[model samples]
Target: MKTTLSKIVLLSLWAATTSLFADSHGDHDWKPLFNGKTLAGWGVVQGYANYYVEDGAILGRTAEGSPNTFLTTYEKYGDFELKFEVKVDEGLNSGVQIRSHSRDFGSRR
Candidate 1:
């Protein structure tokens, strides 16, 4: 009877331990967008504005009421995971464009 109880306890403990990390995969290839020191593969639209890297993030500041400035990816992607950290300035008006299309000037108000 003692041997059976010991086997049951060991089996229960092993099952719990294995179930805790059952979904953990040892193979993953993670790619980062920013290189943390420079904007090597970034494209900027507004020529008058300035953009630089600060603390592993792309920083863009408007140059005296300039037009809309956007930082786009140099490579085009159809469907993939794109993750990044973004911080906006205080009281700043901005916009973000995702998988979208543009219309003609007269068609849009």
Candidate 2:
């Protein structure tokens, strides 16, 4: 709930409906990615920021002397729907990329 680009807990589904949080996944067959208690099954790549679990949500805190960090899932998805809530400072660089293994273009990685 308080993380950056890729710190969200993903729920993959064949189809995404408006009731993504209707207290049920019977229609969409959603599968959660993150456990919400730890960073298990996730990997950090491409940047130097810090990501961790806190208060039943993931937190991605940017640090000095670091580029845009990514907390990616270990498993790959062909196609899916994602619903998330994010809180980041205005004007800070952040985004989530789906199905693309490549980093942003012109990265100083």
Candidate 3:
């Protein structure tokens, strides 16, 4: 009787743990926006810029003696919240514009 009860309890515990783990895995659904290989969906507005994929991140660098560079997403999003980390070199002249329209004549910031 004791052996049978212990086996049943162990089986029940294992089943519970497996169900919990499975449920946890099903709760997350995150989609990537960039394909990281080519600028298929992104739009380049102005300036001499270098864009490439490195370390699973989209990187844009302004070269020396280059004009102001702007990389804008091709897909225009409205009423949406986006969170990203912008790391600029110290004392680097960099500007980012979000939800702002550019000038058709000269690509104003």
Which candidate leads in lDDT?
2
lDDT of 2 at 34: 60
Top TM-score hit: 2
The digit string of per-residue lDDT tens for model 1 on 1-109 reads 3223323332333343234333446554434445557767766664345666655445555555556555554654454343323334455455556664332211111
lDDT of each: 0.46, 0.55, 0.48
State the local distance difference test value for candidate 3: 0.48
Give the Cα RMSD of candidate 2: 6.6
TM per candidate: 0.52, 0.64, 0.54
Rank by TM-score (best first): 2, 3, 1
Q: Rank the candidates by lDDT, best first.
A: 2, 3, 1
- Tell me the alpha-carbon RMSD of every candidate: 20.5, 6.6, 19.9
Model 3 Cα lDDT, one tens digit per residue, 1-109: 3223323332333343233334335554333346545656666566655655554445555555657666666665544334433333345554446687655323333
The segments of candidate 3 whose C-alpha lies over 4 angstroms from its true place after superposition are 1-32, 103-109
Error of 2 at 83 (Å): 2.2
**Between 2 and 3, whose lDDT is larger?**
2
lDDT of 2 at 80: 64
